[model samples]
Target: MKLLMTTAVSALVVLGSTAAMADIKLGASLSASGPAAFLGDPEAKTIEMMVDQINEAGGINGEKIDLVLYDDGGDPNKARTFATRLVEDDEVVAIIGGSTTGTTMSILSVAEDAEVPFISLAGAIQIIDPVRRWVFKTPHTDRMACEKIFSDMQQKGITKIGMISGTDGFGASMQAQCKDVAPKYAIEILADETYGPQDADMTPQLTKIRNTDGVQAILNPGFGQGPAIVTRNKAQLGIDLPLYESHGVASDGFIKLAGAAAAEGVRLPGTALLVAAILPDSDPQKPVVTAYKAAYEAKYGETVSTFGGYAHDAVDLMTNAMKTGGSDPAAIRDALEATQGYVGTTGIYSFSPEDHLGLDLSAFKMLEIRDGGWTLID
Candidate 1:
């Protein structure tokens, strides 16, 4: 009877300890390798670092976070599989990833069906335009990027332009959005061209744009190495018109890949984080962006990209929501939706029932590439 009582007491103590140490599970799916690795790699690093920081700072409500992260390798099918595993097998309370638009869309279905709070890091308007109940995103949409670019072009009196886009999901979506809204900004896309994601050369497509009638400038809407290749091809062809790229390739890697001579004079839309150092003292976002830039560069030893900023914002949004919502998925979703005036590396976020992506055109800053570095134009 004494032995049995001792065993029972030990078992009860173990159970109590297990209950006391229960973790809040969070899941993420990213393309940390393959073609889109540049975007996903930094994003994965930021998420891991942020989770570690949170746990080190006593975690949320005294519960440590159990992060379940997967590398989708830029494949949508793989993203779907991982998202399903996160929902059904891992049973995570919330998710905060999707490194690209394709992967984000793939994970969106699972998140919606499972009713899990998901904060995506992709830059596609479609991800949040229809506004699924459980889905939100951190990056400024490609449409906003388009509008921002056109707004700059209008100021420069550039009315007609040529476009060369990649065949990838993000490239195709932004291409459509740019075309659809070109008229609103009084800009006409006179020449349209395209390239495959794996194509090494884009001279032929750019040559056609260079020779097109009334083409005042060129816009390349794509991610990965395609835009860098396009920049090189344009330089080789000596196409001197102003070149505008999407926010997709807003990284120093792009400039390095394209070569300094080729990438010079290139303009694009980017977040304040890219120009954090130059921001004035009174700017509200200056402190937030500078802190993030400093921390990210210090830890990773690489120049911080806007892609990493997206991950930073997503983690912050999720963790802030978790503060009030605890471990309940529905309550977390509500808390995320109610987010307001949250300053982040990307922009000031304020979510609502109608708008899942809580950013305006003001969130984007027009940037020019000069001497192998980013220069703020606006």
Candidate 2:
């Protein structure tokens, strides 16, 4: 992970490029500063770190990457402006963003019209449907997580469940998917409740579910402050039913924010970011994960979360496509569409015109917090 003196200086030079045509311009619009800032902060940091590493390793196709970042503040209007600026003013060949569904959804049309490639860190499946040829995604969709959660629950002989979702785009989409797929697994949802994104308490919602007759477990399809609050209140209110989180709550930060007593025994699907410490040796992505972890921890002094892993993979995938396609948007789109077995910080990404999401349900593992750390449960 040590960078040579020449490589480090060259990397600085590459990052300093201001002209549109000087190097490979990559634009990213994320919630860099907002209520959801933690989500995008890691993503931005990972991009910076990965760009430095790639540049240090002789750059991509001998043209260094010039990554441009914007803080959308989790606002749709701001995201649109940033996306437009990147495509029109900054003249970036492609865009990479790690905001939630609401912001990313607003920027999609602009990216499509500009005919620039966009790789998203958000997990809403609707973003890729109708499949914008210029758009790609690295995060596991909410529907995929719903499938995994319901399947895993069935395997564990849990059928009666209660639902709690945040009143946000990501939470809404996940809730709908859970409703649609719940019947498929013969799971009965006894009660459904909702809380606002910034709400500091979910005791009322949990109380309603706990009072319901047949609810045996709670399904929390929320993230950020919502999940943290729900976890805290669930323990304080003495809700003894098992708690299942959506894939959005994969970071160690969730455990820290939610508190050990509340976060304990919580089950959720494992993102590639969560398994760096326990990846199978035969996994093709082991080396890349190892290298990314070492360098990221060395620079930042902590573990990389799922958001960071997704952003890192986004750049790696786009860079690989650019290298293969030689900076042409159409060719890069085709190249990305044809990707297969792309080992990255996220899972091995393989995209096609028909299936933009490369990884399957098996890509996730079950995780629980035990002894103040993430432990794979299944």
Candidate 3:
């Protein structure tokens, strides 16, 4: 009886040890079914697909990644709730989601309090402006998008412009950033108009912009269907001025939503993923983006978007960090901050104590919609 008891005890101990070292918990909160679903759905899909691939090939350091994913439905409150659950209940070592700025902000305090490494997929300057200790992000900031557009406008001799933006978090943030930086690029905002996220028609606002004095072009800083509506409205109103959109709408869905004919001649700052096929072979991001695009399209049977690329980079960053940082949250944070020269689908990433986003204006490609496809412009 004593020998039997000893063997049972030994078996239990071994099982416990094996379970402890078998998997690393990673959490994600995305808006997979709401207005921002266009952004979140792809993000969630990419993370899941990447996790599966990693586990299939032998996850980081031989431990499988146990992904705990939740769809916040684009609600900030739900995002907070899911983030809390991830840190406290699931005990995830790191989090790799946030699909929107509002959702990212909602999860910030929760992750910070738990000291978990959080890598956001949202594109807001404020996400990393002050530089939170435990937070990092993959997408380029709204400010960067604004600057890129402004630079393009300056080159085109479009000094005076009108703005139509949404009142949502991303739209409002990009509008403010654009307004703040317009002067630096020798551009003037002659008119400004705002619309609600669900507003079916922006014709009234677009009319106002069209009638504004000295308005050489129109810039729309919004996402979802709002920008699409604006694009259609501009066409209906016979507004011939050059139309520029923010990076928030840098997805194929936008083109389809706005209709290819309406989206033609529209320009936006976007990542290389949008124009992967035409990118020069010498371009460093060509192979990386092509591989990711091919893998994603093959697995999902849908076109790739910049939003998915953000999640791809986020997963890449976290998994690479884990290789050196192990499962410890703080060590992972350090490894992430120390990351340098890592080529990704979006751009080359090099994180530091001062800047968590790790990319500059060069990461963006000014793309114009032509013949129902993206055309890279100088």
Candidate 4:
């Protein structure tokens, strides 16, 4: 955790390059040791690990990548400062970071002003929905997560559902998206509730949900400990309604935060990496997914989440763009837009100018907790 609070600047050189085209400078800003540490810690580790792997395999057309990384500590002000440093001082060609929605939004203007290609790891749709010319992201949009959850609810013939969300920027954004997209799937939002991110308990909200009529299921969309708190409260209240969580709680920390028994049978939208051990051998994503799982678990001694995989995809996508098109930021942006059929741990990515977050609804793996561990749902 020493690396989380400080900014470490180091060079990762692998091959020789001509004077005209020297090493490409890339940068990242992750929240390695703050409230969102669960998301940022693994992401920073993946980026560091992949850089070594890529450099060892002949370093992007014989030119090494000079990756300058910093930990924002989950602070928006720090994110803005680091974004500016990477572009103006370090003159990095591209940046990949801002681990949370709040932090990512803080740095958006800075990346745009410098015209450097930015691939954020934030979850909100507002990060790229307007389609900023120099910005792209790897995580599935909140809108997509909402649609994925609602579509599944419709299939089970469960139309009436209760909803709970945090008051934070990420939660509010996803809450609005869910409200707007629910009618399209013929799902009704029967009971609506909310709580703050730092709130310790959610029994009051669950009590409201328990008294609501025709509430066949419950949907809670928020990251951090919020969703886990809801799970604990629901179990304590003896509410038997099926609980659905957002992709936010896809990490093992959530399972630990809420006791295993309380999280049992709870369903959530996740990526293939969560069930990498059970994926079919013929699956194309299995190769990359399994490799990521093994490397991350071996190095960090912890389970890998889709949030970390998002950072992996961002690093590889930039590497591919530079290898094919060159180091120019514009060319990298164009190549990212042209990415098609790229097998990532999350899913197959296919980006276009109009669509920054490429994967479709199929990218999300429906998962349920059985016993005390993650169980893949067919």
Candidate 5:
């Protein structure tokens, strides 16, 4: 009888320890390989960095976070499959990442059906638009990006432009958004061109644009190497028109791939993280942005990308929600929706029931590449 009682006591202690040591599971899907590697690679590193920091800081409510990350290789099918596994098998409380717009869109149904709170790092509006009850996104939307660029164009009195976009889902979506919003800015699109994501050269498209009438600027909306291709070809073709790239190519990788001469004088809308050091002292975001840059650079020994900060914001959002929500999927969703005035590397985030992406047009800084670095176009 005494042995039986002792056994029960030992079992109780084991159970207690197990319960005390329980960790918060967060799942992520990033395209660490393939076409969108520039986006996903930084994102994956940022997520891991934030996770390590949080854990080192004694974690949230004494529960350390365990991130289950998968590389989707920029493939929609892989994103879908892993998203299913995250919800059904790993059973993460809240999920983050889907490296690009196309990959993120692929997992929306999986997250929605599973009733998990999904925070995508992609830069498309559709992920959160129409407000899927469980969906939220971290970056400025394609629509917001378009408005930011168009507003800048109006300020410069650039009334006409050429447009080239890849056939990828991200490119197509931005193409539609830019076209829809251009008229509102009183800027007319003069030439519309399309190219495949894998197409090696874009000289033909730039040639067509250079010959188009009244094309004051070139707006190319695409991600990965595609925009770099356009930039390189445009310079080679001696297309003297101002080149405006989408926020999709907001990484140093694009600049490196395109080379200094080709990428020089290129402009794009970006989160202030790219120019964190240049931000004025009074800017509210300077503190966090600078800290992130220092920490990221120290750890990775490479430049920080705005794409990385998308995942950083995701970690902050998840940890914030968990502070009040207690790791329950439903509670996290409610807490996430209630997020307000939380500043991170991307911008100030204040999510509401109607708007999942909290950033406005002000979140984008007009950035130009000069001397192989990003320069703030003040």
Candidate 6:
């Protein structure tokens, strides 16, 4: 009887320790490889950095954050599996990531069934559709981006436009938004071309656009070297129409890959995090943006991208909620959904029951790449 009692006491102690250590276990699913590797690479780094920062700052509720990450390699099946493993096997208190729309959507059912709080890096409006009680987002939706872009185009008097999009989640999302809202802006879409993600040449698409009439501007929404292809092709084919790119195409690599001449006079909508240098001092995100930029440069010795900004916001918001709400997934979700005026690297996030996109037109600004630098257009 004595031996049995002693064994039971030891088991209780083990259980108590496990419960105590469950303050906040966060999981992430990101595309750390495949064609979209660049998007998730910075995301992984930013999450690591934010984890360190949170832990060093006395953690949340006096407990440390254990961030478990998985590389989805831009595969939907891989994302679902990673999310399941994080929740069931690791017993993470909350979940973050799904760097792309499709990857995030792949794990929604798992997250909803398991009652885990999910914050996705993807900005598809459909990501938050049906409003999974556990899911939230950090990036502006493609619809929001299109609205902002079209508004800016209206300001610049760009009525007739052409579009080239890849057959990927990000591209498809933007293309749908552009098509849905074109009539409202009175913008005539002359040519809409689609390309595969792995396609090497876009010259044929540009050739089609060049033949179209009344195409004063071109909107190319894609990533993974697609922007470079479009720009280079446009220049090679001597098409000098004003080119407008999506935020996905607003990377330094695109400018480099497209060559300086090819990248000239291109415009795109970018989150404040990408052009924080030009943001006013009174901006709520100035400090966080400043700190993130400095820390990222110190660690990687490279410039930050929209991917990094969105990733940092995703981790920071989740960590803050976990800190305030303990390990209760429901409580964390409420806290995240209740988020208002919370400033992060991306922008000021204020989510409500009716709106989950976080920010509005003010969160984005028109930016042009000139002389190898970002110039905020007035």
On lDDT, the leading prediction is 3
- Alpha-carbon error at 270 in model 6, in Å? 0.7
The deviation in Å at residue 257 for candidate 2 is 2.6
> Tens digits of per-residue lDDT for model 3 on 204-290?
999888778889999999888899999999998999999999888888888999999999999999999988999989999999999
lDDT of 5 by residue, 1-378 (tens): 999999998996675355333489899999999978878998999999999999999998899998888999999999999999788867788889888877888888999999999999887777887888999998888888889889888998999999999889789989999999888999999999999989999988889888988999999998878999999898888878889999888877888999988899999998888888778899898998899889999999999988888888889998999998988999999999999999988889999999898888778899999999989886
Predictions: Cα RMSD each: 6.1, 7.3, 6.2, 5.4, 6.6, 5.5
| Prediction-by-prediction clash tally | 0, 0, 0, 0, 0, 0
**lDDT tens readout by residue for model 4, 1-378:** 466434332221221122134388888999988888877888999999888888788788888877788999999999999998888767789999989988899888998998888999988888887989888889998888899888878888999999999987678888999999999999999999999999999999989988998899999988888999999999999999999999888877889989899999899999988888878898898999899999989988888888899999999888888888798988888888899988988888898889888889888988888877888775
Model 5 ranges off by over 4 Å: 1-21
lDDT of each: 0.91, 0.85, 0.92, 0.87, 0.89, 0.84
The better candidate by lDDT, 2 or 4, is: 4
Assess the local accuracy of residue 347 in candidate 2 as a C-alpha lDDT between 0 and 100.
77
lDDT of 6 at 33: 89
The CA root-mean-square deviation of candidate 3, after full C-alpha superposition on the true structure, stands at: 6.2
Candidate 2 residue lDDT tens string, 55-80: 89888889888888999998889999
Tens digits of per-residue lDDT, candidate 1, 68-108, equal 89999999999999999889877899998888888899999
TM-score of 6: 0.91
Lowest summed lDDT across 10 adjacent residues in model 6 is found at 15-24
For each candidate in turn, the TM-score is 0.90, 0.90, 0.91, 0.91, 0.89, 0.91
Off by over 4 Å in 4: 1-22
List candidate 2 stretches off by more than 4 Å.
1-21
Best by TM-score: 3
In model 4, the clashing pairs are: none
